[model samples]
Target: MKSTISLLLAAVTSLVVGGIVVTTPAPASAASLTEVANFGDNPGGMRMHVYAPDSRPANPAIVVAMHGCGGSGPGFYSGSEFASAADRHGFVVIYPSAQQEAGFGKCFDTWSAAAKRRGGGSDPVSITSMVTYVQQRYGGDPNRVYATGSSSGGMMTNHLLALYPDVFKAGAAFMGVPFDCFANAADYPPGSSRCTGGGGANRTPQQWGDSVRQVYPGYTGPRPRVQLWHGTNDTLVPYALLQEAIEQWTDVFGLSQTPTSTDTPQTGWNRRRYADSSGTTRVEAYSVQGAGHSLPSAGMAARAVAFFGLDGTGTTTTTTTTTTTQPGTGACKVTSTVNAWNSGLTESITITNTGGTAVNGWALVFPLPSGQSITSGWNATYSPSSGQVTARDATYNAAIPPNGSIDIGFQASHDGTTAKPSSFTLNGLLCATT
Candidate 1:
């Protein structure tokens, strides 16, 4: 049933770029879940729960998983697939419970003036406190912290990223509205139908972005990357808000509203990716056809994990290119760069198909140096994580057109030596290197 909520014109567009494919599961780790009675000052009166894998890196990434209205931290922890993903990718998960308001049914604050301002107080502060606590106690990577949620929790996802851009690297909000979409309704009851029922679609992208900028005036730091998901059939929170959200984030990223690429990564999923000149995707929106607020069907969380780069290493900088190769007949050029630290390093390998034909469904094979093992990666999947590793293409990057190159990278731990791989092969054929 369509929502009776009044809405202005919502321009929902579907631009297809590539065909759909399924995702492969990453490696796995066991998990231990727990609850913390005292995390910090209970500014939002939120309860804290956490999930950590049995095996974790010295410094692991952290993800704050919030629940919808009437939901609790423990509830979201058990119901969401993020914890299992943390097990597979080896990260920390912080679940925050929103205390019940007289008329709000335990929804995260997204409308009030306090919730809109940075450090103004509300669920955002409480959630950030939980993140800080995790960082201090578990050695979580401060630079790799992220947030994600569904429904009301999803609205808070937008709020947290807008208010704490320096604190969160990226966020994935499923079925969420734009930041500050509900600000005008501060005087209205909590969970007012005005915003959730499609009344907030009247604002322009610039106006929406301005709302976020106003939160942290004069702060010029990098805005957090955002991933938005919504169902076309959503009634409670009308689907129109999705477009507004895309507009808001695209404006925040200073990118054109036009998507760099569009595709159906999965059947019924119309995905739009907004990237900058460097081809780094800053915003991604998934529109599920004929679906509702109960989005994030099977395997959706995995997509969020990939988008968050949670399946890969921490921040890295290019230091040295170890190998460079030229293209020949059916031959490919491989360039590898390394950024080394104390015991771990991030390696970025770019494969260029210099041949006349496209290389499809390819796999690159190479051996890791002794005592070196991969912990996480992106753009491709690595197996064995150690000696004689195979890097296979992800569903979205399964092909490299002629004269085109794709960059794939991973983070690894080493004993000491940072020796480069002596040789590389693509689909059993030898590749050239410099």
Candidate 2:
């Protein structure tokens, strides 16, 4: 792994963006989303939008999905897959919009003194009020409540987990800083704030943990589990903050600075889990190799729900079983072509839907040969990086018309052997290779 100093140096030499940037704008609000009025106190004056899936359980889980700077609750609701997951798995989603009345430009209040203190007035208090309303009105499962966000929203994820541990079970913060890292800096803009500019990276683990401890002094209740994600190449918020967050969270959980287990769960993703005494993971982190500030990447929302244990199975399955496959006749055909040189190769796979009807929302499963692993991909998202890989369609190319085809491929590295997948399956139906 590259050192934080080296990454900062590289960021300094490259073009950098201002503010906590959201690469994609939130789409229009989903039809299911309804704005709530008089739900709670108006200390922060933030807007609240809630999504209740058509088939929610009697006691459904509640997920707080926050947006980055310049992003709104409705936009986050429509752009993110959280509500879609809620539709599949019974849950209610709370989308809270930050007010620009405080001059934050739709960014959550992570810097204000009131925002950092437990039960103090501001966005945090307003959010808690919203959660309370959900629990009373929607019969939300308090034990299963979770929080997740990107950029500025990510910062609030940390703040919420820190100040309201009793309220939130677990949280996932993408490109966020340590709790209270922006404390008492109400005068500075987010882009130029000392903490946002990477000046708070030198704190010790205990010092960082103390920041969270100060939020609820003398209260020794169970701390919320946290999952931090940041790209190593992120420039808006320095990559070093991810480590600082790990240090703070691991210290708060009383785990060692060293991770209990570390591995690459997917291509370009390096994950570390800090388990408690009972072997339950308390803090987890993911560093995306070579990625920039653009995050909450494809499929991350599902992963966050899985982390929250709201996925019923408490885990994510990347492949499906093919029960409808015939030995010689299948509904799909695939052709894989590879261009290789030395130890690297780029392989393109074209999938043709041979069935009489259109194929929608597909996952193509194939196994990479030994010693080959994917580094990056396009037009699809590949999981596990190597071995048996499942390529899920990107939103734009998710459906294939009758007799139509879609192209997807990836770059990989090998041990001087360039081999293609032996076979392919589309949504569990075996596909003949051409």
Candidate 3:
């Protein structure tokens, strides 16, 4: 029986949107919106929106898209920078909404009593629900699904990192302080204390980011790569505080040395790259020269995904010569890139066939962000249409002749959206649909 199910997962954000360089195109494949779970009735009315590419019965990537202050599920995914790519590439995206006004408007109550209220705050459960929902209903890659958000949503991403480290392999956040430790009333801006309940409360980004790091120490569970983005001009969540938060990340992430910044290929951007003392988990921070507290909504999403070790470092520059006429076949493989460093929207995939049967005419597809556009490709002829991207063997040799295999690669721009496919399929075969 063929079935399509909807899933839900959630997180929160307190930061604001920096600036939109451009509105991204929606994904190429069929885009569907379903509420897999709800928080208070699921008030906060938190729900998850899953974007699936046009591939059939395959395990595609899964990306978690969270919005900034006053933003919820629809608010985040409707015109999201990653929308276009999700449709065109066959990927899955989950949007988690925040609470309502009396609760604290659209932003995740980063400062409200219900925000992370342990057994009370439905936010944590909401995110878990999203993951379960997607897995059961959508067949997403449990390991590949990731979390990303702007400001409070960004804060929510960090919260997921602390709470559900195993649920995701990576995260990309912009203008957000650490989840477990962001400043409160006293630490908030001059008149900001009124908004944060006058400080005397709980932990800030500093505490949260640090505590989560320790709880999921670099040596334990599956430590996911973390990418942070912040603008120098953010008045709401000052750069200095975020800088301190970066330092703490380096420490808890178990980095031996301190992390600093340097300029990148793009102007108005600097990177704070860190390698754990053990050189295991690599962490990076992209600082926008004079950005506000908003999500690089269109900028950092894709770029950060790349920095987390997902993007292609250049196609299989490793193809072997046409050895003997002997037969040899292999499973297909994919290598993709996410901007991770630019717009933070990055991803790359290299799909290679490792079996002995040179399969004839096969289709490969996965999910991507809406804002990122595919600039270049190689090996086989490729086309991204209908919110679903397809690559095929050269007409000269469409078949993966006996003992032959081919590798295909691609690059996607994330713009703050998680570009992980819940599942993927090759040549109509369910290589990984769930």
Could you estimate the TM-score for every candidate?
0.65, 0.71, 0.59
lDDT of 3: 0.53
Residue 369 lDDT, candidate 2, scale 0-100: 83
Instruction: Summing lDDT over every window of 10 consecutive residues in candidate 2, give the lowest-scoring window.
Output: 15-24
Q: Residue 210's C-alpha lDDT in candidate 2?
A: 91
Instruction: Report the number of clashing residue pairs per model.
Output: 2, 0, 145
lDDT, candidates in the order shown: 0.74, 0.76, 0.53
Q: Give the CA lDDT, 0 to 100, for residue 363 in model 3.
A: 52
What TM-score, to 2 decimals, does candidate 2 have?
0.71
Candidate 3 lDDT tens digits, 332-410: 4444444456454334454555555656555554434355556556666555522335555566646665545455555
Model 1 residue 232 lDDT? 95
RMSD of 2: 9.3
lDDT of 1 by residue, 172-229 (tens): 9988888887744442222345676555557888999998898888999988889999
